[model samples]
Target: MYGIKTRLCLSVLFALTLISPAWAQTFDFGEIKSPILFQGNYKYAYRDPAVVYHEGKFHLYFTLVEKAKDKGMYWYTAQSVSEDLVHWTYPKIITPCDRNLNYSSPGNIVRKDGQWIMCLQTYPTPNKERFGNKDSRVWIMRSEDLENWSEPELLKVKGNDVVVEDMGRMIDPYLLEDADEPGKWWCYYKQNGVSMSYSYDLKNWTYAGNAHSGENVTVIRQNGEYVLLHSPRNGIGVKRSKTPQEWGEDEALLTLGQKDWPWAKRRLTAATVVDLTKEKRFGKYIMFFHGSPVNPKNPRSDAHNKASLAIAWSDDLKTWTWPGKNSQPK
Candidate 1:
């Protein structure tokens, strides 16, 4: 059980720097090499890593989940940036998710009308959901710099009759800022599957609808298109879109082998893609996912940890690199 629970407060680590490892040159994997730029700890249920390269640093915000009196979700973000994607600085827990309230990390850090925005999955506290705020959904926050984040602000929305066994909580938000559609933006959240929307301002979101509902999702605009990478019981899938205006059908991008991969314990869940398709970042695409490939026959069935970060790539946004040996199984 967690000893202390902190509420919605933005924790920040400023100006983090990293250097290339000695094996930097020795490691290579297409445009991205081995000796990964970052290292993840299995200790914290590190899930849904949204990486954004700011200036010269790679800021990766992650979710920290633990079971208190009841299973509750909280988030803390960590950051490390490197000019060259070779080695990353030791990761530090920089931000805190609401320990009391259910505060989850949001999608892309966006700039709108010259102001920065942080879209987050604001879950009702266990007390509130079981008692009040039942119809409530997600929200957004405003930030000028990554250091300071605004309070969790509500999103104008309408709840649906859809839900999974009464675990009534809509979490894991991914946003696309000021979409190509001009002053508009798009956001997606996990509703046992997915809930997508279009918003002109960070607040006042117009619900576009649900995408079947899953555990985690990563929606991105890549190579002149919109794509969704998600985890349904079938493993990890790669979805595509024709333009930022339309999100197309999703297909499994790749699957992790049970005993073959060590980093996973269950099927993939809570996955997300890079911040955006821009110049500050180099690689064609960078993604992080959750799951552990559990060996069905192993009596140590309990050895599985339940989450891990998976990697994948895409150039034209139509097809993604087959995530195979590249999977870092712990």
Candidate 2:
């Protein structure tokens, strides 16, 4: 006969074995992959990735750039779906370059009232000039399904006659549904410094103020506080805020260093954060950003060098760990 303690231990072990599989099934960590999506063709480049999880899969949208002899270079947003976040299936373009407008940067996606809304930046087509152009503006599109999108609607205030302007130009728009205030929406875009606007109905928006001195803003709420991520001249930085209008002092989160992350050689920019607090598997935060290679001959032009997407994991949104054999936060 077995001792009482030994028999009880065995019973507990058997119970865990039976429940382990079900526990794993309950929490789905879809496609946990880095550079989670990339383009193999050298003729084309992919950047500015925005992700949204709906139903049972994650839908990712990114800006695709193709250079053609006759058409010059144009950008549009493409779509991919992943169930595990590790493996993905590329689908057709979700937002395509139309005759007169080019979908340049996909900022973010959100679902409300059983409808999906995507906010992005657009530049006039054929000319394809972004600098000092008055036609550039942030537009919103709606879709019942993630695949089929309606026409782009230029967002504006009730009485405004011109397209919304950030600083002097409009680019990289990020949308956030205000957490503290119900029925309020916030749009943060790149201008002089992360500029912001507020709307009650998602249609008419009024310029609020600058949140911080960075571009490519991504904000998330944690512990009743909001954390903002932006790309400055150096690399990615983090700021905290109790409200959407005011951001706290900036802290250096991730900076480009040759030895730190070789792939992120020259600089880092355009950061997007996904919170997985509800998921039992990850239970942390994932940040995706693009890194540019150093142009040795022209260090001044390094900002416009060839770039690729990279990722980092964070527990409390403060400390981050990169991928390697022995990775630690700086």
Backbone clashes, each candidate: 18, 7
For candidate 2, the per-residue lDDT at 316 reads: 79
Please give each candidate's TM-score. Answer: 0.67, 0.81
lDDT of 1 by residue, 1-330 (tens): 323332212111121213433222232335454312332343445555666666655556655444344543344544444444544555565445454455555555666776666666644455523211443356666767665666667655432343323435566666775445687777777663676777675655566766563555666665566667776664667777775434456665565343454555455555556643444244456555555545567735432234554555555554555335456456
Q: Which ten residues in a row have the lowest lDDT in candidate 1?
A: 8-17
Worst 10 residues of 2 by lDDT: 27-36
lDDT of each: 0.54, 0.69
Best by lDDT: 2
Pairs of residues clashing in candidate 2? 30-84, 30-85, 31-84, 31-85, 31-86, 32-85, 32-86
The TM-score, computed over Cα atoms with residue i paired to residue i, of candidate 2 is 0.81
Displacement of residue 164 (Cα, Å) in model 2 is 6.3
